[model samples]
Target: MSSIRLIVSDLDGTLLSEDNRLNDSVIDAVRRFRASGGLFTIATGRFGPSARPIVDRLDIDIPYILCNGCVIADRDKIWEMAQLTLEEIAPFLREADQAGVTVLLFGEDGIRTLRSTPETAYFEQREGLPCVPLNPGDEAWTERPVQKVVLIGDMSQIRPLWDRCRSGYAREYAAVQSEDHFFEIIPARQSKGEALKKLMAHLGVAPSEVMSIGNQLNDLEMIEEAGIGVAVANSHDELIRHASYVCRNGYGEGVVEAMERFAAIGAGSKGGNTYVD
Candidate 1:
């Protein structure tokens, strides 16, 4: 018998398909997992405005670890949240702007941008969320305290910006690239690992009884923290190396493979579909 009782995954490149969409296989697996007396959660850098659509599609009652674990929402209850201090956010945004980076601020209410551009519009459309555009001249928009700031740009261009900030502001903010095209900034004290630990405690489960899967740099913390860290074929090299097992398949199939290989999943688990890779 396996000791695993919980499974957490990252979205975007990790769980979302190449086209940035969630497939039926992933949905079925989640439903089945929940039905089989297991708990499933999404741990991602995405804030509520961007992560909610994916959550709605799951159609299950489960907590979501959002904003790179700075925020944890258990349905109507908010168990944990750590917002970046105004002092920290202001200087960071200033540095990013000076570095020619596009900054998107996320709050409990919605997402805001330092300046509205076609790039931000595209992101809002892609994620199916509304973004409040910030006017460069509106000092208030630029100065508002925030929960998190998402910097959107090509990695080649953003890397330099990140390097500059990192060199001067180590551990001031948890800087992570949730995707190749974007970087997320959150409070340094928070992480998917800490959020999972809290979730396990709240649910009365042990850390050794959790299994986690992810495929990106931001996923590294939770993956390393979990007792059984399973990386999909598409996972980053470092994550693959750190995981206890590497799934042969990628995407949803990879998730299926891990569950079956580890004997933590079974047929007739939940919904109308059983995961078989």
Candidate 2:
């Protein structure tokens, strides 16, 4: 394939470690690669604010494709936006309430949930985040349009919810399983692959000029669209099988390894360890 100029990545599982923090090696490799003329950015299911910490750690100033491409942000400014309509989400929300499943709403104001139950509290604590209870006329929900609808609950309840929503509104929304007990609903037209393509086109780069690394089903589409698709060592079976190359390790180390392997040509060496940081 042709040379790559951009590297898009998934955040939680692919780039960040189990502790939810960025790895030093990944940051260094990205800095070295960018310094050598490549651009890097995040493609995640998280809201912009939620992704900012990792972005800051990487020190990348490029526009971020967030909320599974529901929105793209550049230096805190919105570059593109897509969101599920209130009508589209209302039915799902009602269903969750009836099923006693926990629902979390993410947007510009951070994370807001319908009920701050133990389950929801566990999520908030796991992420070291705060949970806002949905109060009628709660300014947060009313003022901020949702970028993603996250739900945490048992398989029996969540499965039926996904089936019900997917059966009825699949045309308007994309129902993705972020975890065994977690499901996220996004706008159907929005995806990291589509957002990456748009961003590359805007920058005058072709699809064959990009490389993408990820480790989840969501990252599969982005990988399929890029010239070189790198899956981390811990990537799911399908992702590993579909990827053009598989990294030697997982998380930050895997990302660093991929960059070192692919960027060597641009730097004029065979997988050189030239990362300065």
Candidate 3:
């Protein structure tokens, strides 16, 4: 029997294709993995609502890590959540607004923004979730629990913001460049890796029994946390450096490759020269 009891993947650039749809092969692989009594889930920078469709499509019954690990939930219950108070995120929000960067707040209920831009519109269209207008003065909105904050802009705009966050808020929050155009902020010490640990404990699974696959910097921690860390061929250089196994394929194809190599029953052999230090 395979030692991998669980498989965790990242969504946008790992499991899903560029168009944000799952390949039939990837779906089939996931179902097969589950059928073999192996658990599977996803860890992503997306909010719960945005990720729900994928979860349902995959028929995931286990808790999924969301908002880069700030929230952990299944279809019916939320097992863990780390939130940022308005005061904690207000500074960045004001800066983003003044800098003409699109700011999105992922809350417990849904996503909200002070204003919408073409960028946000594209995000809404892609994620299939609307960004409700945030009422700054409304006590109800102000007091809502915020899971994370996302700043969307070109590299020029995002670079400065990322630098500022790293310089100033490094001790208080985790600032990760999830995408070339996106910088995400969550509470300090919170990460997909940390949440994976929590999930493993909840499931009574050992670290050595888990495999994690991802393609971005935001996925670095979880990749490190897993016993078997895989990075797709198109992954960021930094992520590849940390991954124990680097796939010859990218996107969903890479996921399938990893499963066949590590998680499949009676799996044997490295299949090729896929591992790198």
Model number with the top TM-score: 3
lDDT of 1 by residue, 133-159 (tens): 776666676445677878877778777
Clashes of 1: 0
Reference-based TM-score, model 1: 0.87
**TM-score of decoy 3:** 0.88
Clashing residue pairs found in predicted model 2:
none
Please provide, for model 3 over 9-51, each residue's C-alpha lDDT reduced to its tens digit, 9 standing for 90 to 100: 9999899876677777787788888989999999999987788
Off by over 4 Å in 2: 98-100, 136-144, 154-157, 169-171, 265-277
Candidate 1 Cα errors over 4 Å, as ranges: 86-95, 98-100, 166-171, 267-277
Whole-model lDDT, candidate 3? 0.84
Tens-digit lDDT string for candidate 2 (156-216): 7787767766666636677666555777888777788888888888778787888898887
TM-score-sorted candidate list, best first: 3, 1, 2
Model 3 stretches with alpha carbons more than 4 Å out: 135-143, 165-171, 265-277
Q: Flag the better candidate by lDDT, 2 or 3.
A: 3
